[model samples]
Target: MNRETLVLPVLAGLLTSALAGCGGSDDSGPGGGTIVVGTTDRIEATADAPAPLDPAQAYDTASWAVMHNAFQTLMRLPRAGSQPVPDAAESCGFQDNHSEQYRCTLRRGLTFADGRELTSRDVKFSLDRVRRIAHRGGPATLLSSIDKVETPNEREVVIHLSAPDATFPSKLTTPAAAILDSHDYDPKALRKGFEVAGSGPYTVRTEVDGDRLTKAVFTRNDAYRGELEPRSDTVEMRFFDDSAALERALADGEVDVANREFSAEQIDKLEAGRVAGVRVTESPGQAIRYLAFNTKAPAVREKAVRQAIARLVDRQALVRDVYKRTGDPLYSLVPTGIAAHTNSFHNTYGEPSVAGARDVLRDAGVRTPVKLTLTYTTDHYGPATAKEFTALRDQLNASGLFTARTQGVRWTRFRQDAADGEYAVYGMGWFLDFPDPDNYIAPFIGKDNFLNSPYRNRAIEDDLLPRTRQKAQRALAAPEFRRIQDLVAEDVPVLPLWQQKQYVVAREDITGTEYALDSSAMLQLWELGRGAEG
Candidate 1:
């Protein structure tokens, strides 16, 4: 349950082999089989769905899972492994002046499902559309590095960086950089729900109401040339409301694989060999859960209150009780496996003790019996979140320095309230949109941060990030990232709680399941087939 298990030693070194087996088999159909996958809700393929498919608009990990199926970028860092590979543009290597500008030439004849010719214009259109829509909740941060995108011709796209960006091409490998067909996209039309319009292996064929979604089988587009080749003609995704339902479906043989939304208890049951014929694979997840204080609130605006709470709760107990050994206690926002993720907080704070909590409050000239309302989401993360918050409430109360009242709400509503600055303090979880130091910093440290946390660290925003983004070499990314971690520890705006490992369980017929730095790592649909026993 410690933090050392998560950070990638060298970011690029790991990316080299990340998605090795994610590419699907070349065989046409599943012969006579169907791979049923389980999720928490039904997917409606409209622009307005809870998880939309528009690459420019998606920010949530769940949405990106669907979006990636429809769109592709010049290059992609596969979900299972650590390396960057060409997905759409054939091959991508930086052109001259490796500093502020890079140009990539497209492979000929790649086309959208609707037969729109894929070219440099398409890439430009995707980037431009993201900039134009500029959804406050979308992938605007990913596009923050680009100063401008120029398509001089149909085949060539040149991206001018705002600073020296060594990771620009790698950024493009994510779904955030997925190219869309501008010809069919309507900027004026703000359609919500799921809709597909790109060149991935599968197309959104239909959605049956009541939480079950069926995707019309994938057929190789004559122009499609990515590494993945679909084996099943069609894939059906059944969505449930919770882990219990999803697990039940898996046991009942209603689904062939579990994509996401399983509780730690469910994973344990599967791991204990309780579910026969099911093969389980585990990976260190690049996800972190933390307590984010809303600095905009008057009481939490005090560092004493924030630090006191951080000292009151025990991270190891929290992981063991709530996460069921599926999580590692976090000492830094950048989890252990990522490059430059140092245990700066643990180095500073040590461990949770009542004396430490009292000292922080006393030093800030705050008297005992500090009362605050702590909020948590019931639906988000898992069923254990409420119990986790209750534990936090008890721990703080037991410290005798603070009295905490707890509140719980569904995830969607909780997010709306958190964004509106309604809570004094709340439990939060962050699964990276892309695995980078910027992803760790930019969202939580800026003036307009994601958590409604107005915790602005000028060092991260003005100095560390700008300096780090300019270098192309991965080795150079470490020092700057470490500096940001130190600053994050000092500010204490968000208390790093724990980093969770993601687990996937499937019938033994499946193989090649693994974790990706970006939380969307289980590429079971690819390289999964019936085993010899089957």
Candidate 2:
């Protein structure tokens, strides 16, 4: 996992438990024997169609989680608190002039479960396919930097980019960029859904259904070669149709782990040890939730109108009421804890004030009494999202800056509609596409921002983003991102609302399961064994 993908629990507790010598936990929470996990399935907020299991075609977050376990990247980020580290590659660095050519030397003898030797050819093919498929608007836009990929030898893969990019390796860390067996997948058949073939520790055998997706099991690959040391022989990933039902399962010992969907109140209950033997671990994640304004909408077109509306949002109140203080207030498109993140916008917005918003609108000669629609997803991001939107509407309307109308959609149709720019303003959340500022910038800026916001800030698109991506380190990347924040604050196409902190409840029996900020929330199934003495 990449650092951007890491969640709340910091690296403060790396204390070696030597507990491994004592043997793994036997208790899978309140239940006995079977180790079930919980996931939300009622809402298909992402991945509505039959998608190719190929990394190039994997666009939705759900697919990425599944892919992360089955495939290995050249390099992986540290668990929440550590730094960006190597995973599949023994070592990686810039190999040529101006840092235009990047190279990673593969680990010796790395082989897929199918027994095909993993080579630079697989890496080249993976990236080449991302540019080719570009399905459902995958993160291929980031690959616009790539000019070509060359493998002179079996072990060394060289990537030539159109421009100097510091974030290229981070891109490789994303599931959209996962490497796969060239022999197992056909690039042409990817759109139609090919068999799920990958190089991670576990392989997908089947998809079954019950309270959780009872039949989804990942079996250990004896031929697998990667940094992660998985413990379980077979991981049965059970998907809960609902969070409440999932919680009941956890309380009743039906599942070994659950996270992402729990509310702050629910977190408190779990943390209080309401369910015996279930341990709750809360960590700071790289997740950001924001309100996206469709620039095409007449009301939000003017900079002053956008800025005025941004000022009226009570981020703190939302954190308190909606997230139960589990989330931190975020002011930028990028959340805290990620490399190159800036608080410039939050600094500018300051505390919410009705008078302040009114003044901004007044100065722009914009009239009040404007009614706008706010859209939110019903099923994705948990149940509190709709209520959060309602609270925002109440707050905005109470301020008398504007009258608010709310629209809620199920995850599947909602994403399609939102992407079509159906709402005047919508609530959108982003987990990092990668840990870099490029992921944050490219997705929300320019005409191509995912929301179809059509926010064309030439300076940011032309200068800031390019310069930042070209920089080698996050320190050098900061100034450019800071400038991007200024543009976001000045333009307000989308307002940064809040940063989320994730709370996960796992049966103490499950070890090494964690949430990363990047939204992957990938758990190493092999590292997860039953309780000690199992």
Candidate 3:
């Protein structure tokens, strides 16, 4: 279908809502204090860091948390909303009727932390470098649709796409699309250093007290020309080894605000007012946990086997028994709050049934006691993962139709082995890059997806996604997204497990916990501050 006939009307209608959603209000707080944010996430030097802070090279959530404050993208998401608004760019929209050409105009008087003029050329260079370097497991895959970049002048940048993608603007809101100073970074390779240069709300300075990174200090950027205004003059982010250490720091007054890594027990205690001086804030999280099946594996390659295994999964049991009802039972890749969410898995598999599962295996001429190996990470996901896997094994073994063996691997090695197709079935979790339903679907099922599994559906990759992208209003694409969810349920490549609930704990003196979480579930450093007494 031609882009003009299919995509232009929707694009036109979307711009108004996009503009309205992009507006952000300044946060209200007592202000004038150094906010110390504590997290269990490790921030290491190049020698021990999981990934560098370079915008083109960093893809993990930990790195993005710091990079989001240090660097600026052409479009930025507001602290309270998901819609992309102009950041470094004064304004942006489709320049052609086809919706394949997008243009952005640089804001006047924008400069990087290094005092270099920020222009369209830097925007073009930043995008081109991500695709050129294409680091493994990096977010360059987010920009795979861009055919080329055109600079009409110093102020305007035009991005030409090979296909129409309504979600392209949302991609630019990610840290991967962060614009860099052309004069500071070499275009040929990834930037080599702990420091970064960009036009954002804050400029970061890294401190290493020992072998590990001790702290990251973020000072308000005077040159920033964006919608967000820093409530605190400076933010000091400290990294801890685990949730216990992080919680202790908050109780001991070592840290003012704590970001994530709280166990369910700790959360319950804090919620019940057991903690002396801390309060917990809860929000609907965009993260999901699932089980991925390697289609190339001999035992799981059979469609009937996968379907039978799907029937054996009890999401309610997993949530109640394992998660302690801390999260909601998820039945599709698209979480509940998002548009086009359906209970496809429940519709397809019904409740957990031993007889039905056994019949499915018998119909396929498979023997009883089917052997399946389940792999998961012990250190990364949480302490609950081990118990979760154990529960899964007990559930499957109780049916007498399958014998499940569990294996534990560290996160880094597990990710590599999963990509290599070394395991038959594995546990995985997804944190959203953007709040759109497309973010939930495209990244897991699209070509060369993050899963690295061999499963592929031509209808999902080629037809449904492209057609959905043609719609200007995201809600209008509900039918297509629902249909895609049904297809995923039928295929059984990845089974939706559960969706997380976000919990942020802060001291009584700390304000702005209500606005701390952005649309992507990342903490907004600019929203936090201290009370008058603090």
Candidate 4:
């Protein structure tokens, strides 16, 4: 749901509690040695979050990467498709045509790592806990549609939604719906640090220095029983400051694999066989970066102002100069390689032209030199982010239709200020919550978006999104999504910027680097093993 997928960025706060009793590290487990994974994403534990590993608080990509192995959801996104298949539950589907009431039956004899029996009661408790402790940055918002959970028996769990949502199964695949042991986690608070108790394939322990989580070590969960047949018995995730540091670890044989936050220059070197033992694995990415407007801000209150900026800006030049041609200019809210993606923005704005932009402002009777401040975070999306905003400032200012200035803030303060509407235009990145197309559409267009922008369209919010959610067959909803993208392009609530390619760097001895990043953009560490080079 946030940038943590590829670059969820940094979150910080004082620790409210000192937690975690250390667990043993497994040197020799299933696929043999400890497979260390490195990344630039740091652990963002806060007052409400006692541990970076807790499903209730692990919303960022850093935590979510490891959480996939430590926790099990009732349903999970499959290896190749957007549809979710059963994991903890034996089977799950809608019980009614309206897509409001859903049911799941747990697999028989499922037990936590500590040997506690898992049941429908535990499932009910885990889900209800999310509602009770609604952390602002947590993934709990993914389950906001759920009205209630009922456990009629030890195996049967039923969920009633406040409205129709066929995409609910995909939401269950996220960390928000992770099924935790009823005894281990508090019903109304977060279970902090690295202590983990779940029926997934792995059990976790951690090494931390104050608020900084140095590393997390995971071992096979022997008491587990589920469908996911993990290939590795042991894995370790190392947190680094940036991709440069992570690449050094990969080059020095300190870490088995490197994920996310690679610079365009570094990626080019790897592509040209400049990096010795390590090879780069690139896939069409599901991540996107865009500009969101404060709809009520004085500078961009009118529709023409936002459209004019969109017309004058050239996505191609921005990608070539700022991203070093490592990115594809995105023309739609939904990214390329995803089903239902369309060139809605491209169709509306056409090519970059100063004359078209000037006419837009003149016809609207707007005053010349529309004043606006472009706000962004310098520390989050690599060093290129500031340059990206700087490029935007130059483009808008040069057009002479707007007076644009750029503001750079650190990640912590940037998110707060964006939420507070302190900036007229906000720059943010998105990683998919689920592999489905709705993940790209739903979060950005609603009344209460993650962007904190007030953008609710009567036709979209009331009719289109609901109809799209009602379709059990996700592919059948493409028409609705197309219309949604068209409306969003016309409205210009948020501007589509660029889409990036997913990259993974691994040593020649590593295997299964291709499978590390799953369909939903979450890491599957269990896929890593000692074998031939990827």
Best by TM-score: 4
What TM-score quantifies how close candidate 2 is to the native fold?
A: 0.88
Worst 10 residues of 2 by lDDT: 6-15
**What are the per-residue Cα lDDT tens digits for candidate 4 across 68-168?**
78888999877666778998999998999899999999999999888889999999999999877876556666888999999999999999999999889
Output the better candidate (1/3) by lDDT. 3
Off by over 4 Å in 2: 1-34, 41-48, 79-84, 191-195, 208-215, 513-521, 532-534
TM-score list, all predictions: 0.88, 0.88, 0.91, 0.92
User: In candidate 2, what are the lDDT values of residues 1-534, reduced to their tens digit?
Assistant: 111111110111111111111122343332233455566633122344345345655454545556677888887766553234667788888776466888889999888888989898988888888788765445566566789989999999888888888777776666766787888777654644434677787887645432112345666777888766656566666656667887887667666666547766777887788888777666676667778887878868778878877788888889998878888888887767766677767678777778888998898898887788888888766778888999988988998878888888866676667667778788777766555666666776766555556778889888888788666756777877878887788888888888777666666655545322223344445555555533
Whole-model lDDT values for every prediction = 0.65, 0.66, 0.74, 0.76
Model 1 misplacement above 4 A: 1-32, 41-51, 78-81, 96-98, 208-223, 514-524, 532-534
- Candidate 4 structure, TM-score to reference: 0.92
- In the range 130-245, model 3's lDDT, one tens digit per residue, is 98887656677788989999999999999999998888898898777999888878786876657777789889998765545568888888888877877776777887877788
lDDT value for model 4 = 0.76
Better of 2 and 3 by TM-score: 3
Give candidates' CA RMSD values in order. Answer: 5.0, 4.8, 6.9, 4.9
**lDDT preference between candidates 2 and 3, better one:** 3
Best by lDDT: 4
RMSD of 2: 4.8
Off by over 4 Å in 4: 3-27, 47-52, 192-195, 532-534
